[model samples]
Target chain A: MLSSPGGNPHHPSTVAELGEFGLIRELTSRLDTTPSVHLGPGDDAAVVAAPDRRVVATTDILLEGRHFRRDWSTAYDVGRKAAAQNLADVAAMGAVPTALLLGLVVPAELPVNWPTELMDGIRDEARVAAAAVVGGDVTRGDVITVAITALGDLRDKAAVTRSGARAGDVVAVTGWLGWSAAGHAVLSRGFRSPRAFVEAHRRPEPPYHAGPAAAGLGATAMTDVSDGLIADLGHIAVASRVRIDVRSRQLDVPLQMSDIGQAVGVDPLQWVLTGGEDHAIVATFPRDRKLPARWRVIGEVLPPTGTPQVTVDGAPWDRAGGWDHFGPDQD
Target chain B: MLSSPGGNPHHPSTVAELGEFGLIRELTSRLDTTPSVHLGPGDDAAVVAAPDRRVVATTDILLEGRHFRRDWSTAYDVGRKAAAQNLADVAAMGAVPTALLLGLVVPAELPVNWPTELMDGIRDEARVAAAAVVGGDVTRGDVITVAITALGDLRDKAAVTRSGARAGDVVAVTGWLGWSAAGHAVLSRGFRSPRAFVEAHRRPEPPYHAGPAAAGLGATAMTDVSDGLIADLGHIAVASRVRIDVRSRQLDVPLQMSDIGQAVGVDPLQWVLTGGEDHAIVATFPRDRKLPARWRVIGEVLPPTGTPQVTVDGAPWDRAGGWDHFGPDQD
Candidate 1:
């Protein structure tokens, strides 16, 4: 068993009481794995089956107080959110996630149950996309930080990149948008009755299958909505050298969210157009193509406008650059 | 481009001044890629070819104050050390390193030159192992934390796990041992005259070719010596259900190291046997095997004695469990 700096192994409650190896055992034992894991934990490295001959990989780091709030999110909620973000990135590349590895830094005085529950959430989240927890590393740090790297398989299909969109293509998205932001507004006011939005902020349900499905249906370009719709679509516009115009009327702003925005004296459309972390999958298809019911048409591609790359109703969204994860961002 | 919170982007000296996208561009542009990386950066995920149908992966996290001190090492040295630690784990699995992904957390006020130079170090180190920097994520945090995940190809060979060693096997090792520890001791004393030793502490040169070579030579078991030798071998013994005995007489303590030991009133042998972080390779082979000149025989496997799984010259090493990464570890 691995020793803890000053922990008593027999007590086995908090990290300082249980020791290091016990923490590992508690966290790893809670993992639910998939068949692609050729070698699990307990080795210098993990071996994962990659049948497609190529692996798709991405990584994300989440820090407490910045990416999440301990008072607002449980360990389980944080874990699911962490895995969902990176796994959604893999899916955005038109691949199916197969494995996840984690690098965690925990405060030694924290309760061991926190990490065990966190892994439980990670395991369950991975199972949603048929992926497995293969390996990870844990160490002591001043604050709690989780770094996740996800690997995926393309399954013989060419990856759909962000730079493939062409003028005259139509833009669409599958999965919830602005719900997390609306939830944050609700929680910011100290009200939790609208549990749906709060829960959405805590655990995002990404449409993982939509990515490869979009690729199969001949998607021209794709990206995940981690950075708001206009901003993310702006990336596509810049990379593809085209202009993107979103019809604000086409966006779906639920009554509850609208009510929350009204109560807070903010525009609900602002949240729908901007706000991040919902992990929604957005893509562009040929103008003549038929889209599935799950995809909501929101915008269209056009020849580049000299000044603005992304616009709403052929004009800039007045506050487009006013708020984002990049500007004194707290959530 | 991603906006900075409050600094002027045009001034671009610190992370706060350069903005997020500028940071990404600076770091990604410095990378030297390999042919196996079908898609490198600038995407939702990276695609790497895995010809062996199985991918070997490992991850490690290095915190600034705990794993490295800015005053003691440069960002480049920290980057090299972080990459080396994870890459060595992949090598221990009898695989050739192929790609590396990173998750970094940096303070916004930190200089922009730090991460750019850090990427240079990572890129050069990956080049040494014939690997590429494929993808990564960076975000703002209160403290600096680097998390690296390395992927490798096995080339159709089965993995050599720790449980494969048997009694009557000869133990051997390749690469520098205790050099980092001696260097650490030198630096701890506030003296920097021993340039070679201090450099070893800053940058470890892992034998990239030794692992696969040992596998081809029919090595029964293998692992990288990241933990102290006896501590890491103890893991092997427990997993393989055997006993291991090391010969202290066989160890070669350089004259300079012994002289440093004498001046510090410490035994150089202690550093050779118990010091960690000079990422050397240690493996077990059958007694009849003919090894290459690079491999040095140092011990032998024997039946389990139950109380002490690993010993030095037929008895306990004297202070096996008293010192390790798990107990009051500073370096």
Candidate 2:
């Protein structure tokens, strides 16, 4: 194992010591590229081909203390999570990821090897998605912050937007929900888990290919479950002028955090309904369309009434829920 | 003038105060979109056409305290500068900018208006460059950091890289040099500048159109002067396997920064030589090509020796040079 020399006391150097330009050179060294890259690093910009004419793009930022604590998560895990979230966004739009551009900022005193490990995780995730790390920028800052931009190819398929769902469409989801929130609860409460929940929190295993599959199957509307299932689905409901009703019974089978839910004295159903970060692909499709494997029919869309809303089993959920950066943390 | 409530105390009162979903709804409320945007912010991803087949891309991060102190630069100026630098990179690739994706991390206590101002600045700059802001993600962090990804269209022109210069090519530059560096010196050393240099440092006015113009004129190689002119030119020399000889006598024109250089007891030529952050366009053209109006030929590419080097008036320049991120700060 290559033990990362991160935070080593022996190397008491600050970013001010390394300077901006030199640190950039060090970070870019040893990175290789494919033929798709016309110009790589050391140039003013990089040129990449978007042969399909249309490009799908998304961006996300992960802050040091807020998104991932250095003490709780390794540098590699941070990189993986950051890249996964943005790539999931592209997938949610029914586009195949092509390339990623990263912008990283950290204090000068950080261990040099940490960035390499972070890059390793980023490259690992990129390979899994069949994307390339085309270009990136590094600079000095007070804390470690990673911003990633994912570019994707639509492959001539129409983009699955949040506004296309219609009344009578089937609402389906690919992969699990509430797992990350359950894992987050376990981590925040300092409780031990069966490794599954812990892995869920550290590195979310998003259903990478489900987006294109759903698009091929004629998904009307789609979104990744980054926020709670109900909350995110509510977005699609409002955009499509439809009401979404999810059956709680359908969630019982895939809701694997019943034990943790019991220990925390919180409803596992609530976790399934409002918990986020699962990155499951959720979409609306015509009732006549055949659903793909791994996708569970959880609900149905109805015509919007007075206010656009998401309901569970014909009633509004009152559980204080959904992830909010500016709001107080609630388990 | 609206005072930014960025440092306000009573921002997050209760979980119900802003509500996670409610906050996103409010933030994206007034955002307008152009016709080119096939999909906008509330979606899983946005689709934009890259009609030129090739996309020019670049990213940059600006930290609150390190890159710009809040007191020194307004939120709008910070946003403009951030967008400008990334747009300049696309221009350097001989491409026209198309879209920008920004990621912002700020403390929960930050005033909501500050983000609006920042976005306004970004929009203003995008208007100047004929680009649009497509999508972004926001999160809470200790300090404010902005990461921007810029995309551009090459319009079927070949990307002018740093490695295409040949021996005997005439080296020329469009836009001012050393002005930003001089401005930085003035800002840090508490020396008053002649307004132009100070403004230059705060906001560089790079000749964005000159990049594609050089490509149209069949320029062999091109790069933006982010680091000092000598250092950036040296990168071209090393990459293209050529020697570059600069003539200082040719640069006696009265740029707006001459008065500031004179007042500070610093040679204007030194500022012209080693100044950075100018975002000036530098390109190597065939000896017989007709040069643009604003560009002045200042040097020539020579046959490479064993070591790639840049010389002034046939003699090697020995001085503190180049903007090195990890190198020692000359301040």
Poorest 10 consecutive residues by lDDT, candidate 2 chain A:
A322-331
In model 1 chain B, the worst 10-residue window by lDDT is B321-330
Top candidate, metric lDDT = 1
What CAPRI class is candidate 1?
high
**How much is A62 displaced in model 2, in angstroms?**
1.0
Model 1 agreement with the true structure over B139-158: per-residue lDDT tens digits: 99889999999999998898
Return the lDDT, model 2, position A295: 93
Tens-place lDDT digits, model 1, residues A1-331: 3223225445566777667677777777777668899998889999999888999999998899888888999988999999999899999999999999989999988877777777878888999999999999998898899999999988888898899999999999999998998888878878885889989988999999999989888999999999899889998998899999999999999999889877876677788888788999999999888999999999999999766899999898876354332232226
Model 2 spans > 4 angstroms off = A1-26, A29-36, A252-256, A320-331, B1-35, B186-193, B252-256, B306-308, B320-331
Q: What is the Cα-based lDDT of residue B92 in candidate 1?
A: 89
> Model 2, B1-331: lDDT tens per residue?
2233344455533223444444444445534565556776768777887887667888988888777777766778787888888998899889888888888876666656667667777877777787888888877667888999988888889999899999989999998787777777677667656677778887877788898888889989998888778888998998898999999887643655666555655556676777777789899999999886799999999998755388888877656443332232222
| TM-score (C-alpha, index-matched) for candidate 1 | 0.94
* lDDT of candidate 2 over A262-295, digit per residue (tens): 6776677776777777789899999999886689
Model 1: which residue pairs collide?
Answer: none
| Residue B182 Cα positional deviation in candidate 1, in Å, after optimal superposition | 0.6
Chain A TM-score, cand. 1: 0.93
Candidate 1, position B123, lDDT: 83
